[model samples]
Target: MSLLDRFEQAFMPNYGVPPVALARGEGTRVWDVDGKEYLDFIAGIAVSSLGHAHPALVEAVSRQVATLAHTSNLFVHEPEVLLAEKLLGLLGAPARVFLANSGTEANEAAYKLALTYGRREGRSYFVAAENGFHGRTIGALSLTGKKSIRDQFGPFPVDVRFVPYGDAEALRRAVTGDCIAVFLEPTQGEAGVVPPPEGYLRAAREICDATGALLVADEIQSAIGRTGHWFAHQADGFVPDLLTLAKGLGGGLPIGACVGFGAAGTLFGKGDHGSTFGGNPVSCAAALAVLDNLDLDHVNAVAPRLRSGLESAAHPLLKGVRGRGLWLAAVLTEPRAAEVQRAAAGAGFLVNAVQPDAVRIAPPLVVTADEIDALVTAFPKILEEAAQ
Candidate 1:
């Protein structure tokens, strides 16, 4: 039996069956089990920040695993402490970090932080943007606003209010004094790379300041140069009270962080939270390598090329493109994104059908100019095939 057949027999059907069975990757390219090479535009759903098998990440992981691989929270590790310091330094703020193994766990830690803060202040509600996706876990699911995925899992443990994204007035109304926190994504990646309107984040900060509600920015899919900034909220010039990060932080290794600022940082008293493999030495070392090698300048330089190329496509099916930096979505005039995805895959490229009418294109930050040009040149033809 083939790899797909083996996968079907061994794995659950939660993710459905993926079309491609990749074997290996280098830079911006990947080869399937059959050795057909393709440009990997989706970058493992924006998790592979430095591309596959990057020397820095490989060397770091290899070295750390050789030296010291696993150390539970009972013991202190250098890589873990260094990783926390590095993340805090990047934020340019004073905060406490809770390391985890995935974005979902990071959000779950943030959820608990909010609940603790709420209990202290006698608040029982939380607010998040509509269509925003946090994760699949119970606590994170409660914070998620996508009804299709979340409604099936309810009723959740927390009371969360859903507000329209980019609507400052609606958010202002939803986040009353009883609200413990307001969760927002710098860009809603799962919502087809949707970015909030200008001043929306500023409005949220002000609202939280007045209402005494914590502002939590979920940067799982938008941080680590994905939006040409270390953190997407940096573009708006405001720091959140609680910030959750994962995806691309470890250069494809499993790692996540929940950072609490100010009083929120000290909310967790003794024995509040802990994880067994939260800060494994190898993953922390890999994350440290990713942080050291990340090129924000390159990200800013190449983002415009990707965006302008997609927007310049002359195909009738192509409506336009939206998003900042490498995290972008090609908007279509019709709801055929799934068809476009399949056609692009057949034509030796990989893209994601994030929604019915939007295809997500998030390449690695290290992707070269030539690779981008190739995608741009092929996109028109890809659209033509999908249209048929």
Candidate 2:
């Protein structure tokens, strides 16, 4: 049988079958098994931060794997400790870090931390924004606000209150003294890269402080310099009590972290939690390379050029662009995002139709000006064909 057939037979149907089976990738481009090359805008769903096969990432993983790969939570390793220290430095706060394997696991750790911290103060109710995507795990899913996914996985551990996203008054109303924590994404990724109004994060911080609830920032998609900033929350100039990270944390390998700042840092004692493969040396090494190579100055310079390129479009199918930095969404005038995705693929470009009317683009930090120009120049034609 063929490779696609083999994939279909062996893997679960959760993601369905991907249209293309990529063979190899370098820089911002990937080649399929049949030798068809395409610009990769998805960046492995925002995980491949430094792009595919970056030399720094490659060397770090290779060196670490050849040296030491795994160590259970019982023993401490240099890479893990160093990565934790680097992350704390980047966060610029007094915090404690718990490493995990993925975004779900990070959020799960954060949830438990919040629970334990809340129980200490006699609060258990939780709050999250509507349409937010956390993860598939039970505790993370319980915090996710998407009904379609939540309904299928019934009987969650606890019911979490949901309010309209980007509405500060609603958030304030929902998060009272009884509420233990509030989970929020600075910019909603799955819901089409929607950025909240300015000062919204500050408001959440203030409200959580007043109510004595923990402000948990879920930066799974927004952190790691995905935006121009090291941490998107830093742009708002406020520190969160708890922060969860994954996606680009390891550049490509799997790694996640739940960091608690100040008082939240003291919540977990011995025997609180552990993960066998969470802090693998190779993954931590890869994460350090990613951090080392990520150039925030380049990101700050190129992001606006990308945003302007999309916003300047005058096509009938194009509506406008939304989001910050390298993370952006092309809003369509009609519900033809799927058709647009297909057309873009046919034109040797890969984009994601995250919503019926939105296409998301999260290219690697190393994407050059010419690549951005190519996509911008091709977008009008791509949309016209989709409309046809």
Candidate 3:
């Protein structure tokens, strides 16, 4: 039996079967089990910030695992402390960090903090944007506004009101004083890399301030130099009460963090929340390596090149490109994103059909200019094949 067959026999059907069975990867390239090489444009859904098998991440994980790996949060590890300090330093704010094992867990921690604060303040509702995605867990799913995924899991515990994305007026109207928090993604990754309109984040902040509601920015896919900034909201000159991070934080290792600023930091008391592998030394060390080696300058410089290249492609299927920095989407004129993805993979490239009309292209931050130009040159032909 092939790897796909073996996967089908052993694994659950939730994720379905991935088209390719990858065996190894280095930098921005990967080789499948059959020795087929492809340019990995998706970068493991934006998780591999430093790229596959990076020496820094390898050394850090190896050293930490050899010295100390699992601590169960019962003991304080140097790597964990240093990672938290690094994140706080990046934020340049007074905040407390709760480490977790994934983006879902981080959002769950933020949810609990919001609930605790809401209970104390007598608020009972949350406002989230339509088509926004946090994660698949219960609390995070409750905050998710996508009907196709959320409707099946409903009768959620939290009371949340959904509003149109990029519409400041809709958000302002939905976020009343009775709302506990306003959950938002700086860029809606799962909803096709949809960035909100300018001043929308500032307006949300103002609305939350006026209503005494918490502003929660879920930056799971947009942070950690993905958008050429430490945090996406920082580009708009606003700070959220709570910020959830994951994906690229550990450079591919499983780690997440929920940071609360000001009084929101003190919402969770003793015994309120905890995790067994929340701050594993190995993951923390890997995250530290990612932070130490991240190149924001490279991200800023190469982003425009990629964006302009995609936009310059004279293809009838490609409508335009959206997003900032390494996080981008090629908007299609028709619902042929899956076809485009398959065509890309066949042509020795890998991208994601984030939505029926959008193909997400988030390559590794270390991808070279030549590799980018190669993709840009091939994109027109890829779309032509997909059209067939």
**What digit string (tens of lDDT, one per residue) describes model 3 on residues 1-388?**
9999999999989889999999999999999999999999999899999999999999999998999889897889899999999999999999999999999999999999999999999999999989999999989999999999999998999899999999999988888878999999999999999998889999999999999999999999999999999889899779999999999998899999999999999899899999999998999999999999999999999999999999998999999999989999999999999999999999999999999999999999998899999999999999999999
Q: 17, model 2: CA deviation in Å? A: 0.9
Quick one: how many clashes does candidate 2 have? 0
Task: Provide the lDDT at 254 for model 2.
Answer: 97
Q: Rate the local accuracy (lDDT) of all candidates.
A: 0.94, 0.93, 0.95
> lDDT: which is higher, 1 or 2?
1
lDDT of each residue in 208-258, candidate 2, tens digit only: 989999999999999999999999999987899999999988999999999
Candidate 2 collision pairs = none
How many pairs of residues in model 3 come into backbone collision? 0
Q: Against the hidden reference, what TM-scores do the models get?
A: 0.99, 0.99, 0.99
Instruction: Return the top candidate by lDDT.
Output: 3
* lDDT (10s digit) by residue, model 1, range 2-75: 99999988999998889999999998999999999999999988999999999999999999999998979999
User: Which consecutive 10 residues in model 3 have the weakest lDDT in total?
Assistant: 169-178
Supply the global lDDT for candidate 2: 0.93
The TM-score of candidate 1 is 0.99
Residue pairs with backbone overlap in model 1 = none
